[model samples]
Target chain A: MTTELSLVADIGGTNTRLALSAAGVVLHDTVRRFQNEGRQLNDILDEYLAECCPDTKPHSACFALAGPISGDTGRMTNLAWTIHAPEIATRTSANRCILINDLQAQGYALPALAPDQLTPVLSAERDIRAPRLVVGLGTGYNAAFVLPIESGVLVPAAEAGHASLPAHTADGRKVVDWLLANLGQAQVEDALSGTGFAHIHAALHGEKATPPALLARCEDGEAKALKTLEVAIELLGGVVGDLALIFLPRGGIYLTGGFGQALTPWLRQPHLQTVFHDAFAAKGKISAIMQDFALSVIGDDFAALEGCALRVAQN
Target chain B: MTTELSLVADIGGTNTRLALSAAGVVLHDTVRRFQNEGRQLNDILDEYLAECCPDTKPHSACFALAGPISGDTGRMTNLAWTIHAPEIATRTSANRCILINDLQAQGYALPALAPDQLTPVLSAERDIRAPRLVVGLGTGYNAAFVLPIESGVLVPAAEAGHASLPAHTADGRKVVDWLLANLGQAQVEDALSGTGFAHIHAALHGEKATPPALLARCEDGEAKALKTLEVAIELLGGVVGDLALIFLPRGGIYLTGGFGQALTPWLRQPHLQTVFHDAFAAKGKISAIMQDFALSVIGDDFAALEGCALRVAQN
Candidate 1:
């Protein structure tokens, strides 16, 4: 085994995670998280390197950011950080550095994920050769299709979150209309993200509540909060079902992201599971084919680091 | 140059088009179309070969059919034809035979399309390396994404038409509601196909009118007919816009299928063009990126044959 080390980082709006990998495997012990706190990314990287790997320099590096990537540069969506590949290389003393979208990083981590890391929402026979999809429901909603080619995998970029929010039922349409009336547009992210949870709660209960607050209310047996959660799950099911038809991700559909992880218990509830599956499989003619797709929630928080490591190794 | 001949065919519900190709270039002079009149596909192929190219035998063949292809066999959506590759090889006296979806054939045809064969709806600088998309709006609605790989292009299968119909405007939502009430489901095809024209007409006017009759009314300067056409165009624009965001088809979006071709003149009109563009670019924050995708209507009826020829040569 080679002793050469590579650095990988996943940069989000509020925090940045840095980890060291050897032979494309992330070193969990060396993983470290830092709060953004308006600090420069360079300063954070310097501190992480000085503290985590005092005597070692990485040979290569990859950073996955929460915003769009054009060519070799990335901008954080909610922060004032502009990440450039050359700057990352210079700061980390790495020979090769790459930047990819955070969603793409999640996509790359799919094939490397262990079975225990996934909580099954819908278990079906897996077609290992078919494409897989990673749906991110976090601060913002988005998805990436993982195409398995002969060489490795191709994770194509998509702005599906900005697409229109689809409504099939009366309740769904009411929520969509609420989105249109209040947000001035009806987009998937407008109703499926963290803020989307608040929007749904406001739309249903005529009041404001944060996502965590709504969860607390649901724990307190609040009917409106429970209804909000059910509606959100159904919307997710419908959106994911539409994506399944488009991408035909027969390998699996892996739900990832902070908000997605938080909803795992609710998603696992038998009644809510049916709510999702019904909305998902409600296609008119070809609904039967929906059974071929297996759905799971990715429980691994370090999957993006794993993905960045994989990308660095591939390059 | 080798004088080896290859066979290519595009099989639709009503007609079957067959042609000969040499060196991956379709021979327009050898192209022939036969109406199905309740004839078997095998008999049609026999008659086509006997009439069109009696002197030459194709060394290989490819057929693009309007239906699902599982493995080496393809089942036609409208016709009672099961196209098995081995059977086709035996019937055509070809050593190799391949079957692909009709939309995929359209996808492969993109790179080889002549400028004269396409009419620009929204022209922009083409990104030669980016992915392309083919959206079909005929008897049924669907889209296929064309990924430009190192070797060739990969057109992934998609059943987008069977997904939910997205509505952002009052008029659009009304149409969606009508589709849901009438069809028990609101799918993209329910509002975007040949039959969808009739559905929109009925939804708006509360009267029955065939697609052709409605078109004639529009040509005759009927108000309701024009409104129906405009509404359908706007719906198409919205659906295509959503798809554009998801697929990021920077190369271009090529509108194919019979109904789409028929809508070209109206789509090109200045006022209607604005309507389409308005609906297509109405995505809230990311609306600007929609301008990056060029939209065009494919005018050539035999482009699928050209695609089959390309596929045959590729294999």
Candidate 2:
């Protein structure tokens, strides 16, 4: 049997990973790291192709660029790349070049992920036919929701990160107000992202506090660091509850992205579920029917890459 | 063409509207406005059918209820009515029966509504191809979101009203705290529904303010009443914004229900724009993309009735 190779690129803020595969099955796939901080996208692309697939005419390429991919011309928030699909297709000499939201790429990996990839955090054993929400907590918070339909699969792009964070406590309200005073807007992403952790830790542990340092201290079981993480996870779980109420993800909730990875280890802490169920327990409305839903974290790997491959298979 | 007549019901808290239609045209439709508050669903159905449909041996009937139609059993929050298709079929002697969400019934009306039936509030307008959001604000706040797919439509039940409201102001923060103290939970519906209005009015104008008087004063534009409505619209807009950001409504935001009818008059208020815009603007993530969306009131009369007719026509 003969196999054809296609190109796949997972475009991130700091690095650009390009690989070659056949029908989404990676074969001789490789990457070429670039300093997108300084160079042009074309320069990076030329270097990647030369190193990975020289003298080979690939069928097509799928570009999963970070930031918002609203239309044909997608611009990166952190990097200097303003990507155009048609333009990239011509430049790469490929048959097609499609762009999807990075979170959507993550959504594609929802089913591809195995039990080993996902560690059960707050298990609800949700209904299989129910819609599952894919929340990404990275440099920013975003969500991509998927529902099983009579048709096949449905993925809706979600900007839930900007949706207001529920302020249940006085301290929660204080964090909201403080973040608003500093950033002009109080949002879940502003309070739950890595930068959000730094902001909260800095407020508690002075200006020198950072997300990495806080995580390290929390690893050491530092009380103050643990407190900060508890509050962050509490807020994060609260938002997940809010999202679940809004979407009613019968398929269960899957958390992803870099921040999701960081928060994974801390999910089992008792205080997290306390805040989660507290917020989720809405009364006098659809609260009673809010059963059969639980939160879980997606297995860490190249979910985005797997998602991109999934999209190729789907399209 | 000789046509067959079927049973159709718009089951609500207070009354049930039953109609007999042939070839998707109503032959006889009347409201059997029975108080569902005191009676069992079976008793109400028995009483409702005896008066409404005397002589109809139809094939299939679709009952649009105001609750999650996850499976055979359906439960409504505002009333004591739980319906099952098989149960209704056995009693009514029907071939097939469906109990779908009321908002979903309204969603089926999306493709049928005329341009004149909509009163456009926002300016730019929506893409129409993207999934449209259908929101209901009547006896209580609830929502039913429908996703458009290539094969057909995917209507997902969302207790979106129970989603937490994000408070931005000191006044709002105080309100959030008060809700937590008094109501034990601070979900959005706790502040934005019909009951929520009563709570907001009480919170704003002491414990003595009544819904009838407050609504009347609001209608008369009395200062306090107007202020209450202002907060109501702002809170309403905030939730609308939340929904907009969640789905990025490409088909536009269709606000329905009696509450929507009340809000129709105040659609262009400055507070409405501020609260709604703040929900999207805070992200600075999908802000530009959001500008393309517009808000509108679904003004079609008896939309649920018309929706029932549509089901007959298409099915």
Candidate 3:
């Protein structure tokens, strides 16, 4: 007798990862990555199924997309792809299909991730029943609030990166003014994303540099590069702190995405760590309560796929 | 045979309003108000019970407090009263009791409010199935996000008032700088609450004036007073817009509390209304999406009591 498999995929800007799971456990060996290039998502999925399981019709399918999902449809942020649940179900010959935001997928995977896959930024007692928050910092920024319900968890989508950056100190205001003048709008994503790092560097030094080049300069103890990192870290801390108050994520905050992972090492440095904690905990009377929230980084690349599998299983 | 009634109360700083409900409907005739006058919450509850339901034991009880709630315990923000749910349950002879923030109560009361009770600030399409937000601007500032679940609506507590103020324009930053210099922190409450009105008045004109006094001056065509009102409304709009992005409350954004009510007339003024809307929809790329959120003022005085009754009935 053959076991019924469920198909899950994570669709990003340049790559798409496809995997199969039985009962909710991902078949790690069956996972494969394919370049999006300029082909449609349906074509990629057809190729993936043909190569992996030609004769087997999956029981269910779920796709986690790096963009907004409205009803049963989703549009990719970086690529020219529009995903419809009904189309995917028809293409995969699956019983049911669903689409969710990538950040939400990260939120659902939080409960299933092992300790070795997460690195703690701040250690605190976590209330298992409380809500968790997943913050994504990549080509673009967004967040998802993971609410634990009796049946399962509910991950609500948020467009926080498009909101105005929170400015406290005079220096912060100066950066905000610079962003307003240069970018025409001072949004959180303008200063906290991968390209945001470059913007901050440009704002301070009036020179263009990629995030990698700036990171290398910081490693060499360059004062300007170090200041850029400090500004970005402090801004991130302030934004995350504001989010914590809004969401009350006592289950802890998990940072994900390429930019977030890249900043993990810099976030661990003694001086930058202090800057982050201070900005995060500087909410006047509620500063003490803010300290109760633990922070961590999700290092698993397949977490979103796992999240998609878990979502399919829950159905 | 005596009918089993549910005891519900809205405990504010200066006054405590108590009422009895039956079958999820609040008995309007049983509603009574008593001045706290340095009295404990238990004492007020005892007197209310003695006067309203002398010969009967309540089946359940719920209190809506003007403060934070941790588990079943709550402390009044502007009054020295601590409420413990177990104590209230025992005193009222109720099977169980729950404590929730007043903003949360407003959130719960949204569905129960009549059309006449809500005056629209910004008329737009509302998705009833989507989340709603209640923002309180009275003695203190806070918000509650009302998520529609299968069982009932879940109103999550938020301390968004303590978050840093979002400033975009140079003039707004100047006001923020003033708040940072004089108030030691530039929080949302520093420029959006009842006292914050006076702070803005003082910041612009370097004069001490009450919120009411400022309003009267604005009516009398005082430029500084009008400017103060403009600043407050713009700040409120910017903050609410940021919140809309974060919560994605497509259901609606409800403004409650005394200060919010006072600002309703001012928000209706043509020029000030323009100021408010412009500041609110100023979010760059996602500015158009902000227009979809319907803004309204909750004018019901007994909404919190009704919310308490609803909570008891849900139990």
Candidate 4:
């Protein structure tokens, strides 16, 4: 069961974060963030294991990937990393290994999240029993809804952000078309992610810039950068509004990751609220009831990891 | 629980569908459909019991309602009838009395649905374990998603159709606004229900008319009703598209009732697909994966009643 020690790792494109813990709940001695540019994850894991636990072999390994999980292997969406479970388990000699879509793993952690952990963005009576909608606005945009089941004792999560971000307005249409023409990436994530900043920047000002540059410019009150983020945030709100209507997560709608912190402050912002509220208002009373649920962003970097442990705990 | 026969009735505005099932599964002998336009439901039940099972004093009763269910009593959204649960339970001497939003009951039935019972509108390898989304386009529009919890389930039902029906285009905006002003009902359900026909008819002809009359005209290939249904259907598609993005129902999306049937045969029809698909396609891969979940209109008229029975069985 790996009760003594379990390996919990979150592998993104540029940085691979690994920590050894007891059931992925409480961190033990091994927490390290390393760049994956030079070595494969197994080589990294092997080096870490021999250095950290020379005599003992862990029984269970749970991983969260920053990409879509196909079978037992997942290729990192943003990095040149290809991960397969069997190879890693065979090499690591771990008894059990499972890889879950990061968003799903994040969702699994919703139940265990301390109430204090959530900074309420929308203050409704946080009914712990209602379905909770969890979304991640991270390196790449994605979302998951953790819905209460069986009389509110359990919650199942899902990837919801990839669901289209159709432009419902002239401005939205402009943004979408701009992304298509400039970014040339296929989906909403292309425009919703950090990379989306470059596309948005180029669309608004006729030249591309990285997310950091865009954020820096916006912080410095650059007109073009602020305009780009303004539109992007509105679009994000509209999509979140659409999801709230679809899931009716009475428990609440949660925005996770650093991106959420960067964006959620714009929660009550007029442009974003208009798009968010109007999207559901088109559905009728569900819009009215949306006021019944809380909206917030979970500001934890290790949410997915915590969720991975939480998911395993369920099993 | 009572071993004696209990009634599980599904009441709509027109016909009352009743099932005298032991648990939640329907028993052939207990299926009863009674026309209730001229009489009260209590009267109808009394008569049915007299003719069908005079000696049986039922134990408890549950009903699936087509209108919003908040308080104890109920009134049919499209009919002039009152259903007081406690009053009925007391009179009928049924030991238990309960009412559920029809869509919530439908959500419960998804895990138990047979393949043959569902006709695929779109083919997707559904994650059966994932949360399943259920939508009903009946007299009033609503939706619910059944979230699979640790071992139990949560049925978060929503009156989704009324939330907001944001117009996606100039044409959509014009049609929706015109219908709203002319129909004197701006709510999504007002312009998008059976009543929506009259609104569409008025929009097409610049005057209001009855739905039945409009349908009759359309039956003879009248362009007015056909055109109106097209606009209404387009709006309906847009609403569904919004839902597709909101829930990310990768498990599968089930559409129930006559309106869904009328639309299903038309998902492939011209502008309809664009109106619906574009809404979901707004995001990209989520749109691609959504195609994996088959969209279907349940063929069985008895689905909700069967679903109610299935709900009892699960318990």
Candidate 5:
């Protein structure tokens, strides 16, 4: 039997990564990246087809976009592009096409991700039958609850990062106050994303420092940068623990995105662990529930692409 | 054809409310209240059957308990009784038996509740296809997300009240600090439930007062009592907005329980509306989403009994 290829793309604000998948596995050699520089989605698709896979045509396609999807159409909130799946299907000569929200795609990716692609941050036993959580913290923050339903699993997306930020300690309160004064709001994403790290650094150092620079300085033994990271990680842990209580994801909490990857090294810190457990122990059995979760960071960058492939199989 | 009856009970920490339902409608007259005074759930069932409906034997039974239920048994967190559904079914001469968490019963009650059973709090238009939320704020606090799945709807329960509390204002922070010092941590339930109201009254008045007395004083133009209610409502609005962003419950947030009913009179207060809208307006479409939701308070006391009969029908 011959392999049938399907097209998949994980479209974000700045970049759109497209790939070909056969039998739910993304083809490593068929991967391509296209900058989203004010160009229409159709134009990008046309260029990709013409240059990347000159002769072969995919039978189906799934575009996981960074926007709110309404029926067959989607408009990227961060980028100036609108996508309609039917239009893409007609243009690409494909039998079927689908559009899913980015966070939903991330949720779909969880089941398909391999063990090697994951790094256990806070190791603990997991209840395989229970729901799991996927949290994205890069340029922005979002979460998805992967629920097991009768027909199949349902991934309900969450825009929790836009919710209010919580402050636990005195210094944490000051940071929250600073965020309210500077950003006019203290949403969790305001303190938990890439730019959020810069804001925290600015709040501490009285000047902005890039997230990477701050991390490097912290690694190089700079007390100020180290303190910023400590506070940031503690806040992240606190928020994650709070969300854990909300969903009761006994399967685990998986952290994704570049910022999450950066925090992988700090997961074992006593401050982070203490904050997470303390957040739950404040209540009743929630502390025991917290102990049941296995925390991990998605090490693979292609997980969302794999998720897009999974969507194609579903269709 | 004669309608078949099902025995249902909403077992709380202090009381067990038993009733009979036929074809999804609860028989109000058959309802019986039994105090749960360190007795087994089977003993209560026997007493309820002997007193309430001596001649009629129900086909099935569903027990909605205020505790964590596993497989066939449940142990009440607030009381000493351990309940086994299979044994109860055998003793009651019922063919089938099931157990559901009290909050899950509240979730099932949403679709069965009539308009008169609900008091509209926020009268905005709603998107029926989107998910709805059921928030319980009585002796304890919890929430459930009623999501529409492929086979049917799934009401995934949330222990949100146990999550970390958010404080956006100085007075809110003071409440947080007071809770942290007194309770060792500040969970949302610590400031949102009936006991939470008493705690807030104590924090503000330098002495504790019953929730009923505090509300009466607030209505009677007592300055301290009024201030406490204002802060509590603002905090409640803030947390509700946060949950809204998480679920985007366009079907709206339905507040339930005795405390929630008490707050219905204050729903139109500018302080509550301003705080709720401001929480969402800080972001993009969340404010619009908030506007789309039609908030209401569930007023039916027999909702769980009706929900139990619905469960029997599904089985």
Candidate 6:
């Protein structure tokens, strides 16, 4: 049953992060990352196993992927690799293998996160039994809601980021209208992701700039860039608030993604919280429900891997 | 453990509907409705029991309420009645008493609904294991997501109607803006309920009219009233589509509530279906997910009572 050792992997579009763990606890020293340069997942697993466990093979394996997993197979949304759990188990000579969506993996990892691994942006009572939401703002954006149940937690698959972005202010409305005209739809991803920085920058200042350059410009006190970040943060707050009301995630709202991790400091500031509270406060009962939610950002990069280990341990 | 007989009630702001049941199956002949003019829920229950079950006392009771139930007590959202499950158990001489939110009761009833009780508005595959959404567009609007779990089902408390409404088209944006300016926020309830008809009528024609009157005018082929109905239906479609993307309720989208049932004919037409698809078609995967969902309008008015009985039976 893989009680002592298990192999866990978090497979993204560009890279795969792998680790060995015991009872869902990842061994930090055994962690490895591999780039997906036209290599199958089975090959990566073999390489990781040979390097990390030379004496004994892992008893089981569990994988988290940046794609949808149906039945025994998973197909990456951006990458070309197709993953099959049973096939991986056979190829790795493991007793069992399980695959789940990366967001669900992140959702599963929420309970195991240490205090140091999470930075709470909105401090409030944390009810462990309530639903918890994970909103990822990276290359593209998405979210997953983890529900605590009797037998096990249920992580409902969410495509919230693809839902249209809502405008909360006059300026926000103008920007959203312009995005809808130019992009055919004002998706939440259009305003809350790395690529979204370009849209915000272009909307604020009549030109496009890469997110890194934009962040650098803002750090140098560029007025236009600063406004762009404020607007982006405002949009992110609005979406998070909407989700809070929709899901009532009294457990917490976890922002997890490369972009979200980079904006940890900004997210913790009063401006984002103020905008978030204001958005939900437009409705009375929903306002109270949202105000009690604990908001945080994931500080650990290997959360998905940890979650995969957790699932493997559970199985 | 009342295995043979149970008393179930659906208590709303204006009235209470009570019935006797055996093993979660409601006895239609025993169903009774009482006005809630100035009395408490206990009083109404006492009167109902005295009238219907004078021969014997029910062994268990479950009540579906119009407000949030915290701990053992429930306070009505709009009415003055406050109900305690334990108190009801003591007063009614029942072995067990369970109190659940009305929307959750409706959600619990989803599995028991007959084919004739559900009008399929958007036809697609129905995966009973997936989450199902119940959106109430009656006097006051709200939604509940009924998630299928291993043990039973988990219907997380939802106040989704208060969430800000999203605009999909330029016309939708204009209506939403006007609504926001007039009502402080463009809540889904503002444009998807009975009161929404007056606002839509005033927006379309320069005057306000009752919902029934507006529906009558639309039936008589009045252009302005027809247009108002069209906009309201469009807004409902957009909200449903947004929820579909947010929750990915592959089990189905159930449109319950008085207004929704009354609009069943229009809701089943191609226009609402087209708008709903268009609202979700802004994103690729979300569009596909939404297209695969089953959308229906619930036809049962006593579904909440049935759900209460179901909860009692489960307990």
TM-score of each: 0.96, 0.90, 0.97, 0.81, 0.92, 0.95
| DockQ of all predictions against the true structure, Cα-based | 0.79, 0.61, 0.78, 0.31, 0.62, 0.65
Looking at candidate 2 chain A, the ten consecutive residues that score lowest on lDDT are A25-34
Single out the weakest 10-residue window by summed lDDT for candidate 5 chain B. Answer: B277-286
lDDT leaderboard ranking: 1, 3, 6, 5, 2, 4
**Candidate 2 segments exceeding 4 Å error:** A1-5, A24-35, A47-56, A204-208, A271-291, B1-6, B20-56, B269-287, B308-315
Error of 4 at A39 (Å): 2.6
Candidate 6 residue pairs in backbone clash: none
lDDT of 1 by residue, B64-183 (tens): 999988779998988888889999889989999989999999998888899999999997888889989999999998899999877678887778888888887778878887887898
Which whole-number lDDT from 0 to 100 does residue B223 have in model 2? 87
Top of the candidates by TM-score = 3
Model 6, clash count? Answer: 0
Q: Over the stretch B1-315, how does candidate 3's per-residue lDDT look in tens digits?
A: 865699999999889999999867899999999899967777888898898888888899889999888888998888887889999999889999988889988988887899999988998899999998899999778888888888778887778898888888666777787888897888898888999898887777789999988889988999889988998999899999998888889999999999999999989889988999999899997898898899999999999999888777765
True contacts kept of each: 0.77, 0.68, 0.75, 0.32, 0.68, 0.63
Residues B160-246 of candidate 2: C-alpha lDDT, one tens digit per residue: 777777778665655566687788777787777667777776667666576667788877879877777777776776667777777
Q: Report how closely model 1 matches the true complex, as a DockQ value.
A: 0.79
* lDDT at position B126, candidate 3: 94
Better of 2 and 5 by DockQ: 5
lDDT of 1 by residue, A239-262 (tens): 999999999888999999989998
Candidate 2's residue-wise lDDT over A1-315, tens digit each?
A: 766666777788888767776776545336445667778778877887787768887777777877777667787868877899888788788888878778887776677787788866656667777788888888988888887755345677667777666667666776786777787777778887889888776655555587888899999989989878877876776787778877888788788878888888778666665655555554345566556676678765577776776666565
lDDT per residue for candidate 6 within B1-315, as digits (tens), equals: 534789999998888999999977899999999988977777887888889888888999989988877668988887878898899999888888888889889998887899999898788988878889999877778889888876567788777777777776656776777786787677777778888777767765658799999889878989888788777877777677778878888888899988989888876668755655565454644466667778888999899998887777765
Give the distance in Å from residue A43's predicted Cα in candidate 4 to where it truly belongs.
Answer: 1.8
- All candidates: CA RMSD in angstroms? 2.0, 3.1, 1.6, 4.6, 2.8, 2.2
Model 3 Cα shift for residue A228 (angstroms): 0.7
**CAPRI category for model 6:** medium
